[model samples]
Target: MTNKPTILIIYTGGTIGMIKDYSTNALKAFDFSQIVQKIPELQQLNCTIKSISFKEPIDSSNMNTSYYVAIAEMIENNYDTFDGFVVLTGSDTMSYIASALSFMLENLTKPIIFTGSQLPIGDLRTDAKENLITSIEIAAARKNGQPIICEVCLYFEYKLYRGNRTTKISAEHFEAFASMNYPPLAESGVHLNFNEHHLYVPKNYQKKLIVRKKLETNVVILKLFPGITQAVVASILSIKNLKGVVLETYGAGNAPNEQWFLTLLKNAIKKGIKIINVTQCSGGSVILGHYDTSVGLKEIGVIGGLDITTETAIAKLMYLLSENLSDDEFSSYFNKSMRGELTNR
Candidate 1:
C-alpha cells in the first residue's frame, strides 16, 4: 500500500474514452481497467489510481436526470474510500452535467474535478491525455492535510472553472468550455498555478457530505426572439405540469414591454409557475428592473437569474423544486447564491 492520495476516475462515456481500431478505423470505448497501461504518464503522479465505467457507456447527448442521480450515488457509495474523484464525460454537455452535480452534492469537502476532451483518446493530436492527467493531480492536491478544492469543478484546456459557472462555447476547438462570469480556480501550465482565493471552502468542513438525488424535470427554457408572437409564448406557458421556465431575456434582463406578453407571463405566475429571467448573452448579468422592459417582469415576480448560466439555472430549479419549498422560499433561494451557481445581487 502507498501513502499517496488515492484518486478515483469515473468514466461516463465521451470522446475522451474512445479508442480507434487501426485495422477498421472504427472508434470503440477503451478498457478503463487498463487505463494505467493505456496512459502510462498517470503513474508519474505518485498516486494510487483506480477507475470504473458505466455498465453500458453512453454519449453525452443522452445525459438525463437518472444518469445524474446514478453518478451521485456512485460517488456517495465511494466517498470514504477515495481521497478525491475525477469524472469523465462528453464535452458537449459537460457544463450541464457538471452544473447539476454541483447542486446534487451538498456540503462537499473534497475535490470532484470534471474533465473531457474534444477529440478521441486514440487520435494522434488528442487532448485527452493532458486533461485526464491534470484532473487527477488537481483531485489529489492537498494543502496542510486538507483537500485544496472542496467543490465540483470543470478542468479543460488548462483552465479549471467552477462547474456551474461554465458554458460550452466551441464545438471544434480544444478550448471548448469557458467560465465567462467567474475566473479560473486553477490553471495548468509550466507549473500548476492555483487561484487560491477563488477556491471554494465549505462552510462546515466537519459536516458530512449530503447527496441530493431528487431533481425535478418540469422545467423548460423560453428563449425570446424579435419575431416572437403571443401564440408561441402562450403555447409554452401551457406545457402541462410545467413547474418552471428559464426566460432567456435580452441584455440586462430586458423583455418586450408588450401587454400580451406581460399578461401571459402573469397568468403563468398566477398558476404556480416559477419564471426566472436569464440573459441570452454568453457573458454578463441579468439585472432585473434595470430598465423599463424588465421592471414589468420584476413586478410580476420573475426572479432575476443574476449572472447565472442557463445550464445552472435549470439545474438549480430542478434541485429547489424537489425540496418542496414554498413560492416565497423558492424565490428567496434562487435570487441568492447556492453552490456558487450564481452571483448575489
Candidate 2:
C-alpha cells in the first residue's frame, strides 16, 4: 500500500459530476474513471484518490432510507482501508442526507466530508472543481498521524459545517448552505483556515465504529401556521403507523395556546406518539417553558429540540425511535446534543 493519505470519492449523483456534450450540448454524467483527467488539479494534492459510484445514479428527491443504508454500509465496509471519504450528492436534499448519515455512523475517527455544486462540472463558471478539490484536501488533512475531523461534515462554498447542523438556504447561488446554530468548523480562503476550536473530536478514537442501519421512517413534519385548523392537526396525528412527528413551531418553540391544539398533542403523546418541538426560524434554540405558550408543551411531554434544524430533528427522531428506547430514554437523548446536532441551555 501507499504511504500517502487515501481518500475515496463516492459519487452518489448530482450536478457536480455532470458535463455537457460539445456537439449535442446535452448534460450527461461524467465517467469518474477519468476523474483525474477531468480534474487535473487533483493530481497536485498530497493524497491517493479512488472513486466508486452508484450502479444507477439517483436524484436527491429519490433519496431514501435504502440509499442511506447503502452508503453507510459502503463506508463501514471500507472503514479500515481509507483514511477519509468525500461523498458527493445533489444539493436539494443534502441536509437531510447528511443529517441522516451523522446519526447513522458513530464514533467516527476519519472525515466523512459531503459536498456538491449548484452548477455542472464542465460549465464555464462551475463551482464543482473547488468544492471537490477542497473537500478531498480537507478529508485528507491530518495531525500527528491522525485525522483532524472525526465526524461527518458538509463542505460548501467556502465553509465547512457539521452535517447535522447544516440547512440548504439557497436554491440559486453557489453559497447554498447555512448553519445558523453553530459557527463553521473550517473556512476556505487564501489558506485552508480551520477553526480547530470548533472541530469535533470523539470521546475515544479507538472505539470501533458502530453502524446504526435501522432508521424508523414512520415520521412526519408538522409545521404550524396561523389558521391551521384542528381538522388538519387531527388528521396528521391520526396517520396510521405514525411513530414520530417533527413539530415545526414558532419562535422559541411557541405554539398556539388554544385548547384544541394542546389537547390534541397531549392525547397523541398519551397514545405513544413522539412529538418534538423545533423552531421554524433558521436560527435560535427552543427554550421550552420560557413562554406561557410553550408551558403546556413542556408539561404535555413534547420533547424540546433546542437549536436543531427540522432536517436534523427528523433524522434524530428516526434514529432514536428505532433504538426501542423507553419514553424517558427517548426524551433524554433527544434534548441533548448526541452528535453536535443541538445545544442544551
Candidate 3:
C-alpha cells in the first residue's frame, strides 16, 4: 500500500474561512476541523489532510512581521512531518505575506502553496472550494517520490504564481492576484499544467530549513510624484532609525533632477541609509541609467530594484536589513536576485 502524502493546512484567517449566517446575514468563522466535511472532494485526493488554525484569526490588514515569523516557525517545526503546506490568508495581504515567507523560510524542499478566496466559502458563488481543493492537490503532487513544487507559491483563481512575484490585482474578480513580471508556474484548467521552466529550483535539498525571524521594520516607501516637495523629502529622510527606503520612482526609474532632491538622497546614503529604486509600474524593470533623469539617482548609489513589486520590495528590505550586511554588501545583494524576489541585473 502506498503511504499517502501528508498535507498540512495552516489557516491564518481570511474570507476563505468565513461562512455567512443566512438567518442573521452576518459572517462567522468556520471550523477548520470540519473542512473535509464541508468540502468532501478533498477526500478524493491521495493525501492525508490535516489543518491548524490561528487561535484568534488575524485580519489580512493586521498582517505584520510577528505573523510572518509565526507562520515561518509553524512550517519549520513541522518540516519533517508534512510533505507540503497550504496557507490560507486574506487576499489583500497575501502577496506581502507570501513574499515575506519566501525569504523567511530558507532552503525549503517541499511545496508551500499560499491560497485564499475572494468570497466567503459558504457563498453561493464562492471560489473557495476549487482553490482549496486544487491547492492541496498541487501540494501533494509528486513524481518519482519527489515533491514537484519545492518553493513558496501563490495559487489562486486557477493560476499558480511564484509567491514573491504575486500582487493582488482585483477585488471584484475571482482572479485576485497577478505576477506580471514573471510567468505562471502552473495553471489549473481541465488539467493542472505545470510550467517546469518557470518553477524555482532549490539549490540544496540536503540543507535543513532555516527560519529567519529577525526583521528590521525601520523602513519606508518614498513614492515619487509630480509635485513632491523638498521639505517632504527631507522629513522622510530625517526619520529616526530609518535604515532603508523603497523609492518608487516614475517610468524607467526616473526621478526629479533638482539639486535639493539629489542632495537629500546623497546625504541619506552618506548617513548609512540604503535606498532601493524600484519602478512604480506593474511591469518592466527599473532602467536606472537608461534616462537622464535617473542618472543622478544611480550616481548617488541608490540600488536598482529590477522588476520587484512594492510589497516584495518592502519585505525584502526588512529581511535584508536584519542580516547586518555592510552598506556595499547590502547594495550588491539587493540588486541580485535573492529568493527570486527580483530580477538579477
Candidate 4:
C-alpha cells in the first residue's frame, strides 16, 4: 500500500464549517482540528489531514483582498510541509475569491481547491459532508509523485471547475456554481473521471509559487439597460477614486449610441478610467465591432472583455491595478488572457 498523502484544510468561515447544537438550537463553529472525530469516514481515505480555522470567521459579503492575502500567506508559510490545500468559504463569494487566488498565485504546482455547502454542516439535510470529503480527496490526488490539480479550482455538486471561470448561479441549490463559458475539469460519480484534455498543463512544475498581495478594489460594474439615463451614467463615472469600470453592455457588447452616453464614456477614458466592455448575455462573448453600437465603444477606447464573466473581470482589474501599470499597459494587459479568464478573439 502507498503511504497516505498529507492534506491541509483551511476553514475560512462559511456554512460548511458550522454545526447546529441540539440543546441550544443554534449554529456554532465546529472545530476542524478534531476532524477525524467529527467525521470518522475521513479515516477511510488514504490520506492524513490537518486543518486551520480563522479566529473569527468573516462573512463572505465582507471578504476582501486582505483575506485572500492571508490565505496565500498561510500556503506560503507551509509550502514545503503540505501536499495540498482545501479551502472552505461561503458560496456567495466563492467564485470571486477563487478567481482572485488564481491570479494572485503565479506558477502554482499544487492543488488549491475551494468548496462550500448551501446548508450548515449541522443540518440534517446538509450537503457539507460530501463536498468536504470529495474536495479533500481531489486535493490528495497525485500522479507520478506530483499533484494532479495544479491550478485553483472549485468543487460543487460533483463537478470541478477552473476557479477564474466560475460564477455562482444559485443560493439555495446544492449545485451553486456554474462555469457558463468553460467545461468542467473533472466530475465525480460511481467513478471519478477527469477531462485531461481540458485541464491546464503547467510548463514548469518546479517553479516556485509567487503570491501577489496588493490588489486595487477601486473597480465597479455598470450594467446597461433600456432607458439608462445620462445622469446615472455621469454619477457612476464620477464616483471619487474610481479606477476601472466593467461595462455590461447589451448582446454582443452593444450600447446605446446616444451622444450623451458616448461623451461620458469618452470623458472617463480621458480621465484615465479603464473601461472593459463585456456582454450582458450569460454565454456569448463580447465582440467590440459586432455592431454599429459597439463600434462606438471600441472607438472610445473601451477594451473588449471577450467572454469573461463579471466576477473575473472585477478580480483581473483589481490584480492589474495593484501592479501600478500605466494606463496603456493596463489596457494592453486587460485585453490579454493572463489566467485563462477570457477568451482570445
lDDT, candidate 1, equals 0.93
Question: What are the TM-scores, per candidate, against the unseen true structure?
Answer: 0.99, 0.98, 0.98, 0.97
Q: Candidate 4, residue 162: CA error in Å?
A: 0.5
Superposed model 3: Cα runs more than 4 Å off: none
lDDT of 4: 0.90
Clashes of 2: 0
For residues 221-245, could you state the per-residue lDDT of candidate 4 as single tens digits? 9999898899999999999999999
lDDT of 3 by residue, 1-345 (tens): 136999999999999999999999999998999999988899999999999988999889999899998899889888899999999999999999999998998888999999999998999999999999999999999877778899999999999999999899998899889998999999999999999988887777788888999999999999999999999999999999899999999988999999999999999999988899988888998988899999999898998998999999999999999999988889888888888888776
lDDT preference between candidates 2 and 3, better one? 2
lDDT by residue for model 2 over 1-345, one digit each (tens)?
246999999888989889999899999998887899888999999999999999988888899999999889889998999999999999999999999999999888899999999999999999999999999999999887888898999999999999999999999999999999999999999999889999898778789999999999999999999999999999999999999999999999999999999999999999999999999999998999999999999999999998999999999999999999999999999988888888777
Please identify model 1 stretches exceeding 4 Å from their true place: none
- Residues 215-301, candidate 1, lDDT per residue (tens digit)? 989999999999899999999999999999999999999999999999999999999999989999999999888899999999999
Candidate 4: Cα lDDT at 154: 96
Residue pairs clashing in model 3 are none
Clashes of 3: 0
Q: Evaluate all candidate structures by whole-model CA lDDT and list the values in order.
A: 0.93, 0.93, 0.92, 0.90
